[model samples]
Target: MKTVIRYPILFRAHPGRTEKPKDVLVPYLHEHDVPEISEAETHIAFRSQKYALVEYDGRLFSKVGKPGSNSAEACFGHAFEKEELRRRPWWIPTIEGDKVYIRYAGQPLDNLAYYRLYLDGGDKARETMIWPALTPDYQRHLGGPRSRNEFTFQGLVDKIRDINGVQFDAGREEHRAEAERLIVIDGSYWIETTPPAICVAHEGRMIVELSHLPNWLDHDLGRQYFPLTAKDEAIEYARRAQAITQRSEEPVRNFADWTDFRFDDNPLFAFDYEGYSLKRTTFLLGGDIARAMTGNGEIEGKIGSARARAVLSAKEGARSCGADYRTWPDASDLVHDVTDAWKMTGRKPGWTEIPPKRHEFGTMICERAAQMADSMPISVSARSTWTTSP
Candidate 1:
């Protein structure tokens, strides 16, 4: 489940000459090009880098840039760094060998200079950050001294209301003229221009990879471990949704507290120096059990409302994955949604959907389990120290 925030953007479009409308495969538009194209605009917040950079040449064929000619979806690709190209840019399907360009229809800058990046920032924060971080010369490419203008921070756009409606052709010349006049006032799309750094994991579910991230905080290491940093967002969300409200949601999970047992083993890293990706830490040890009990799937249906579903989930999770959820800090919400779904569904609280797993937290490791089974008293160290020794 996902919600996209969209806004209006001014886009240039090339309606092919009635004779060759489909032949307009334009990437960069210039005034010096054969002819002019039409313009459309709108927004996507919670998204897109709303800023557009248009540079026009007052000199010569600066008069002939046909930007919208390549309006078809087939002509563009992503503006990936050399490192990203090898990774199969999330948006581009072409392998490293396929030649393609980033698709940008942000605005109609026809009859203008030629530049490839139309609406940059598909790389999310990494891509969007480039705009604000540009040096004075490039940042002030707007020509005059408007205090080095950047893409103006236009406000958010409501994707639901400010939407692009049906597409229709300009049937007849007179009809086209009337349509143009009507569209100016009553169009499906707004005439303007912009997810946070979020990506749907390959499992095909909406996982918020970022939130509240200031682009300036991004650097080499942050970028390198983005796959890990994203975990912070996920963990935070998990805390909010499942952790007990009264207790501090500061992470208490074992993995979250584990120091590097060994760095070279790659337990704490997303990618090695050689660019080889490593196994990412899997944090949700118990949630999957709940999901399994309720028969919920990544894309399929499940029982109950969000809270009810959560309740069912938590109880089910707590029942089977007892070892992890028995007293888990975050299990509160799940067990309730973390409380009532099971009861609401007429299932008893003592219900065990699966074989129960027990948390040994009440006892110490190595000796406590055997001691508890043998009915031996647990011994405590006289000096309360954090160290563990045999």
Candidate 2:
């Protein structure tokens, strides 16, 4: 199997009024502003102070927690889970329109993050908060909400402030409306609280615009087609298609010449090789390149089994399925299936009428016809070979 290497990168948040969230954007933001920020940033301490930023088109949501004053952890955890990280490089939620940033550990965010966000009040309340797993003393240091049922949104918020090391809600003390349509969320941030997440730091707010996320549910599979970017891929597609429909050639052309022929004193048939060149070419050719045994104009446009071709000019309903001579079961099956389907549907599956007028043989056809002129060619006529009138 071929291998592909994908490197993990972090986004950061910009400084503003409110303190940056530790679990999301602040860490990434630091890296963008810092020098030599790499994947290792999330693993270090002093260098892991950076952060990233991202703005999402959709809303960020949080999960609902179990009943209790300690529900804050559950709330934040839920929010974390709701963040569709895999879909977005980073995400930013807005509170009253102010941007709130979020990022990942060295690990990439998955579908679970989006689920967590919805669980939090982030979607409904439109508030931004962070949940730090690395802050060992965070719970001990920070207190809970006012009531048992009321989770301490302030505690996580405060922790985000201390660790994130950036202020996005700076001058905008009050909520403001977005400008035009391309509004930016340079107002929130995050910070690294522990080991795995440490590598996420060492960068400034990494900008992640949520509007760019992909919506898989809306993707239309019906319109999807295989890309022919490589020569091998194209060849493979053709080979698979050929395996489906048994044909002498990948592309069937010249239906009249796709058969065997012999020059016999059969008064009902006459082979017509317009020129001498085709006579020679046909004599040397063994497969479909050879002309039909009986020359009849009606067979020029017919496509059917050898048996069907043999009796084509004799009678309309006298043709056989040619199953005995078929090498591939699939070919016989298709012919039988199509024939049966057409019979049952009261519709003919193929046309056996010759064109009203033939094109000028030109040099190409002249050269080919000349080669076969000396030999009696195979012909699969749809009508009687004894008649010359249309």
Candidate 3:
């Protein structure tokens, strides 16, 4: 997928203006006609020089008057350079191969003229660095100094915001509120862009950009809605969500210590649960356990197959243990299956053992189970007496 940024202002130049140049000039000089030398001595005189101005057919051209000047050598040199010089240079007429040639050994007049006109201004930096780097194609794209597509860094922030329709401050608050309303309507959602990046909100209060997060952590928080719980376990749940998304590594050693990086306390990450209940807690817990067990930590290899097996195993275990509670499996049984599958697959079992005495949810599950068992009647009369007393 192509990368997307939340605010387009982060890029160096406007997208519309940064296109590659089309009219880049070729580096090497082109072939041109050589002027005839009037005599052998003239050819010999200019043979030692690299360049010469030649007068030929009442017109002048710059020709390569290299050594061993023969008639055939007169037809080749840079045509562009000759044009730039206005066909004027001091020359001596000579004969070579019985044809007249003009040879002059001097600096390229056109280049000197160009330097005097364009480079004479106090823009040494542009001449020395920028101008040299610009190819003929780029120069054509530039079209000159007054072209509309020229890039400028000034007022860039406002320009970016205008182009991308991004909100800030008070406007951002409204956007955040809308996001929270949408999340409550659905469970969770992704805010997509052309070049994609992931950003999430919590309770319309905090926004986090997953792109800035570690790859493992970002993948772990796979686009999903989380259940709200007590602060500690909610954070733990978020961490586990990340781990489940990871599917390759052992469970985190100290989930509490993990950081929850946020961009700001904007409405973008807000939640509205004024009428919600805690009944789904068990199911959410079961889902988390199932997710945690499925894959090895590695990003590549047979993660898909492993996760499939883990899910199947968890379901089977839940059924055998009579733990499936309609919408979700039993949390305890799910955790057990997940750990067993991880061990079977030669992966680290990251979660704490079940029937956990100190674990927050584990202790809750055990206490709840014990309470139910105690409430059951030992005999028919005992059940009747308890019912009557209640």
Tens-digit per-residue lDDT, 299-341, candidate 1:
1133445754554443343322211111222332232232233
TM per model? 0.17, 0.15, 0.18
lDDT of 3 at 276: 13
Highest-scoring model, lDDT: 3
Q: CA lDDT, every prediction? A: 0.23, 0.23, 0.26
Residue 376 displacement (Å), model 3: 19
In candidate 2, what are the lDDT values of residues 186-293, reduced to their tens digit?
A: 221222221110001001111111121211110111111111122233234334333333241444222112222222232211112122112112211111111221
**Model 1 ranges with Cα > 4 A deviation:** 1-66, 71-95, 98-390
**Compared to the true structure, candidate 3 yields what TM-score?**
0.18
lDDT-wise, the better of 1 and 3 is 3
Query: Candidate 2: where are CA atoms >4 Å away?
Result: 1-131, 134-167, 170-390
Where is model 3 poorest over a 10-residue stretch in terms of lDDT? 1-10
Off by over 4 Å in 3: 1-313, 316-326, 348-390
